[model samples]
Target: SMFVTNSSFCTESKECLEYLLVCKTDEYEVRHYSPTRWVSTDAEAYFMGVGAAMAFRRLFQYINGANEGGFQMEMTAPVLVKIPEETRMWEPAVYSLGFPLPAAYQEKPPAPTSNKLYFSEMPEMDVYVRSYGGWMLSVTSRLHAHLLTEELGRVGASYNHSYHYGVGYDSPLKLLNRHNEVWYVSEGEGSFTSQRLV
Candidate 1:
């Protein structure tokens, strides 16, 4: 079974304990974070994606490296999940899954808006993914995508779908400059490496 929660960061401490109880009994676990500490302002949206991707990469590497008994790690490209605005909770217990961006904003422009989170039926396919860090402007992101496509072709591994999900780690209120912003590629597949971004 999959579970979802929506809560504010300030109230997270209280809600987390409740989530832990549910997770203990649930067959599949997934958590969502919203009203996030990182989303302080609208301008930071673009860079936030990059930061999230990098964090995820590091987390994945650390978990996989330990490779404890019967533990297996699978990589995924980020997809935006449309969830209700009332969800909260910060960690993935077992079989954690989420889309990088809010679903309502997926095709919308970079503007102020909000939408309800909607869950959909699961797809019947699998994809490989790699994460990237640093800024992903038009020139850089596209270049990376192309390189990935080429490499995947050579290895007979290709993506059925590709998306660029950004996560903002810092609060946007403190920054008035672009340099203060960071972006991460939450999910995608190719020969791309986290080192390339560093």
Candidate 2:
């Protein structure tokens, strides 16, 4: 229903539905990649806490209208991040937080005042998704991602590791029933199927 920005974690927002499940977990759903406009910058590992919040705020204001494209856009799930690699941990790593504009606005969305922002469309594709709970601390996010990777490997699924996504659906203010996820792009060409994880 509304989006609230807090740098310690992903941006917060409310939705009429309990945050779209996207697809059933372990279900191997094929979803058309949605379109989102995002901003990217390098942040030292130690500063991810504050840096991320600042970046989100800048982008958030673009839609909220610090310039011209002023509209209270609905926030989307799994604040997609191009999950960084550990070997480069000591050095500054790039983080991207996308605002997946609704399809109607996506084609002609407002321009961001900041050059740090960019827009792109996610092509339709199949993906492996895993759900988790709790705050998205670096360690916690990494663990869920690792588990998702393991599950993909166990199922003999092909995945692209260059990028991994972390999705969050609950506001930090909400204390219980929080939903977060780790997503991997699937390499399979067949039509998407929903498989029960159990």
For every model shown, the clashing-pair count is 25, 5
How do the residues 19-93 of candidate 1 rate in per-residue lDDT, one tens digit apiece? 221121111112222221011111112333443444344334322432224233332222221111121245321
Model 2 weakest 10-residue run by lDDT: 189-198
Q: Write the residue-wise lDDT of candidate 2 on 45-134 in tens digits.
A: 444445566666766676676534566666554455556545364666666565555444545776666766666555545667676777
**Candidate 2: which stretches are off by over 4 Å?**
1-48, 190-198
| Model 2 residue 26 CA deviation in Å | 5.8
How does candidate 1 fare on TM-score? 0.27
